[model samples]
Target: MKTALRTTTKTGTFAQALEDFKQITKVGLAVSVVFSSVAGYFLGAETIDYKVLLLLMIGGYFMVGASNAYNQIIERDLDALMKRTMNRPVPSGRMSVNTAFIIATVCAVLGIVILYMVNPKTAMFGAISIFLYTSVYTPLKTKTPLSVFVGAFPGAIPFMLGWVAATNTFGIEPGTLFMIQFFWQFPHFWAIGWLLYDDYKKAGYYMLPTGKKDSATALQVIMYTIWMIIVSVFPVTGLTGRLHLSVTGAVIVALLGVGMLYFAIRLYHEKDNAAARKLMLASVAYITFVQIVYVADKFIGGY
Candidate 1:
């Protein structure tokens, strides 16, 4: 009975630790970012390389995880003030700042080293992303509404990072990928900002463009959505280097944009959290599907 009790306690402790790690690193968000990197890799590579692809996945996750961990560390007090964030490991007292710092440091170093194996450019961009997220974006969150725009830089890197990893070059193709994701983030994050305005205010975060959930903010969201849609279809002009899109792909992407735009318009009219939440979901679906369409157009449609 004593041995069994000890074994059970050990298992429970390990499970709790695992959960804490996931909470600190934000596993779901990290995985989704990795998905974009992988999609970009598929788009840029003339021939698939499973080894480099595997490295990209692991290295990308570590970089994003480190960024999130550091962000939580910096925002622990602010996080504790917001209901949406109070349950996170650092804010909840489930983990110490020093421990989180250690995890972030380790992940950052390991991520950079792993990415370096893919190519020096890949590792350099990974480092830049970490610095932009933790050093620049995290501190700016409570300072100004423009932080969303700043955050978009690092958020946009993974997609282009994949192209760089695959081709070992940064050119028009990767630049175009970067621009698409960069523009898309405005609507995606602003919708989230609108829905969480109350909670974010508790933490002193100014995420919305107009610093309030009003028509002006919604208009900016619509504007950015239109820009994103326009950029998404630009490849069909056959001017974006190897990242060309077929006519069919461009039409489908335009349709997806229309769907997201409809939600944005609804939020503009409704001006309610429900509408904001739907717009947020639509933005996510639109970005993911657009990436899929781009990759599919490359391989299947031979564009």
Candidate 2:
């Protein structure tokens, strides 16, 4: 009985920790940071500094966690109203605002310090990402539908942030990565916005252009999906200079873009919740696979 009880208690604790971590930051942001840094390492001449990369990952996680915590604190009321977010630690009162604030502040400070150790430019960008996310984007969600576009700026930074951290300089390679991600965010996020439009409205958040689900929103998603494909393949054309890809690499990249395009088109035509959900999942896979391909191609003497 005692052994069983202990096992049950451990399971519960693990669940709680997962919930708290999601509330504090998010898995998406953490993964993005790691991927971007890896991509950046490749961009910075395919050199890796394990120590610096470790520091940057730690700092990135902390900063992202801090931003999420602050967002929850500010949106606690709205969060409670949205079915999707109602059970979050803050809205559910599983954690208090005061405690969350202290945790966030400490994390932000530590993140900045670590990033500074990596490079001043990286540190500055990290600070800027946090500032824009917490200070500007969070509040704007309730005020306007355009907030999604505004939020994309910070959302797209992690990939490029890695390049700057790796090279301690901003140049064409990082810029290319930045542009790819920047364009990618729209279709990716719009798919999510479609899936959660109703949930968002209940909380007074306008995540879609029309603040309603319709063809216009879906069309916009399709357009951006097309743009994302175009940008993702740009490196192959030599327009990205040092980031140029070889024919084989370009073909692989084009295949990934086609995968993304397939989902986007499915979502556009179906205009159903299930299709949108699938598209969102596909978008996640698309980004992860493309980043992996990019890093591998760079290292393996691929184009």
Candidate 3:
């Protein structure tokens, strides 16, 4: 009976630790980051390499996970103040700061090594991404609204990092990909900020540019959505280096942008959580659809 009970207790502890790790790493967000990097890899590679793709996906996920872990450690105190964040591992005492730090260190080291196995530039960018998120973006949240802008830099890197990994060079193609994801973050993150404005303010995180849910902030979201729409359609013009799209794919992407813009406009009109929630969901759909459309367009058009 004692042995059986000990085994059961161990299993439960391990399972609980796994759950804590998931929360700390923000698994869903990390997966989305991996997908964006994979999309960029596909766009840039002349001949797709499964091994490199696998490394990029794994390295990217772990690097992003490490960044999240560090962010949680740094913001544990502030996180405890926010209802939405209070349940996170470090804030809730489910995990210790040292425990989380070890995980972050292991993940960062392993992730960078794996990416380095791919290319030096890939590893360099991966390290930079972790530094930006943990050092720059994490602390700046309570200090200034421009934190979102700073956060966007690292957030935008995954997409371009894929291209650099595949091509081993930095140029217009990756530049355009970087710009697309860069502009996309404003509307995407602002919509999320609008939805969680109260929770964020509870933690003193003024993510919205205007520092409140006012007309100016909503207007900024709408304007960025507009620019996101424009930049997304650029590949179809045969102007964005090796990334070209067929007319049909362009139409589909444009239609997807319109869907996102509709929500952005509605958010501007309502300027409420409900509209912001809808816009947040729409932004996710817009970016995923646009990326899928780009990859599919290439596959079909033999580009």
Give per-candidate clash totals: 0, 2, 0
> lDDT per residue, candidate 3, 131-222, as tens digits?
99999999899999999999999999998999999999988888888888999999999999999999999889999999999989999998
Question: In candidate 2, what residue range of length 10 has the lowest lDDT sum?
Answer: 38-47
Name the best candidate (by TM-score).
Answer: 1
TM-score of every candidate: 0.99, 0.92, 0.98
Candidate 2 Cα RMSD after full superposition onto the native fold (Å): 2.6
1 or 3, which is superior by TM-score?
A: 1
Clashes of 3: 0
Q: Scored by CA lDDT, what does every candidate get? A: 0.94, 0.82, 0.92
Lowest-lDDT window of 10 residues in candidate 3? 236-245
**How far out, in Å, is residue 25 in model 2?**
1.9
Q: After superposition, which runs of candidate 3 have C-alpha atoms over 4 Å from their true positions?
A: none
Could you report the Cα RMSD, in angstroms, for every candidate shown?
A: 0.8, 2.6, 1.0
lDDT of 3 at 150: 97
Q: What is the lDDT of residue 1 in candidate 3?
A: 100
lDDT leaderboard ranking: 1, 3, 2
Better of 2 and 3 by TM-score: 3
